[model samples]
Target: MAAALDIKGLKVSYGNIQALRGVDLTVEEGEIVTLIGANGAGKSTLMNTVAGLVRTREGAIHHYEEDITGMDTRELVKRGIILAPEGRQIFPDLSVKDNLLMGGYLRSDKENDETMKTVFELFPILEERQNQMGLTLSGGEQQMLAIGRALMAGPKLLLLDEPSLGLAPIIVSNLFKLIKRIRDMGVTILLVEQNARIALKTADRAYVLESGRIVAADRADVLLKSDLIEKSYLGKS
Candidate 1:
């Protein structure tokens, strides 16, 4: 089977600064692949490039077998490549339902109502506060809104950037569980997370990025047990 997403020799830069350097990564269908790195390590840059929010300096990006390099965000979303960006970029003024509806703006399908129901099922709190303004929700709720909004697009491959950034520990735990549930629902995931320990525990495969390059790639469990990983990212001595 073809991989859900394939990227080869990907290079990205911003004027004088290089963000990603010859990055090669793939996310197979129905699997959770996590990318872990410190701040400014090009993790977000990779995500943006795949989502067509950032232009690449060189290399190729493909979804399934089709070349999607430089494709616009709307085109990518229509093709089931949806991004729930970092910082939970939900529209503050819109109601929760409206925010979700915005995610499906490109769809003319009749099943949008059904998709909204599915998102409500996945996040019961969203159902309870469907009429509430996006800015009124708590941090965790806003994050849920972000992911639910992405699901509203009927994603085949979900690109999640830092889903656990500022939540309490218990909330983060629950969020990872929900992420696993999402994977079980058959959506392939490409995650970029700063919380390496939890990310490795939740993901099936992992990649380590440092200074804009991939330094290690392995099964998530393997990386979790690695001394180097433990020492550097996991905060273990």
Candidate 2:
């Protein structure tokens, strides 16, 4: 089967400062593919490029075999390509439920209802505090809301940027479980995370970005056992 998402020979430039150099990546249907690297590794830049928030300077990105290299973010969302940006880009004043509804803005069908139900099942706390203001939730709850909102779109490919940021270790662990559950339900994911250990352990496959280039790519477990990983992100034992 074709990949849910495919990025080939991707090169990105931010006014002469190249962010991605000949990057090639794929997310198989229902797989969790994590991009792990240190700061300035261009992981976030890769996500933005895939989402069409940043146009590609080279290479092509395809979703379900359709080229979406330079499409609008709204159009991509309509096609079930959703990105839950880093930092939980939720409206502080809006209620959590309302913010989730915003994610379904393009949907007029009962599909979103099913999606919301799944999201609630994944994070019951979100359902419990449905009417709470987004700003009122703790960092973990806010991150849950962010994932819930993205789930609202019922995306075939979910692009997540640092879902575990600023949360307790326990929360991060539980959150990764929910992510796996989503994958089990047949949603493909392309995650960019700063937490190397958790990401490499959870994802089936992994890529390591460094200074705007892909320095490593392999099965997650392979990366976990690599000396390069210990030298770069994980300290040596």
Best by TM-score: 1
Question: For model 1, what is the alpha-carbon lDDT of residue 187?
Answer: 96
Q: Candidate 1 lDDT, tens digit per residue, 31-59?
A: 99999999999999999999999999999
For model 1, the stretches where C-alpha displacement exceeds 4 angstroms are none
Q: What lDDT does the true structure give each of the candidates?
A: 0.95, 0.90
Please state the error at residue 227 of candidate 1 in Å: 1.4
RMSD of each: 1.0, 1.2
- Report the C-alpha lDDT of model 2 over 136-218, residue by residue, as the tens digit: 99999999999999999888899999999999999999999889988888889998999999999899999999887788899
TM-score, cand. 2 vs. native = 0.96
Best by lDDT: 1
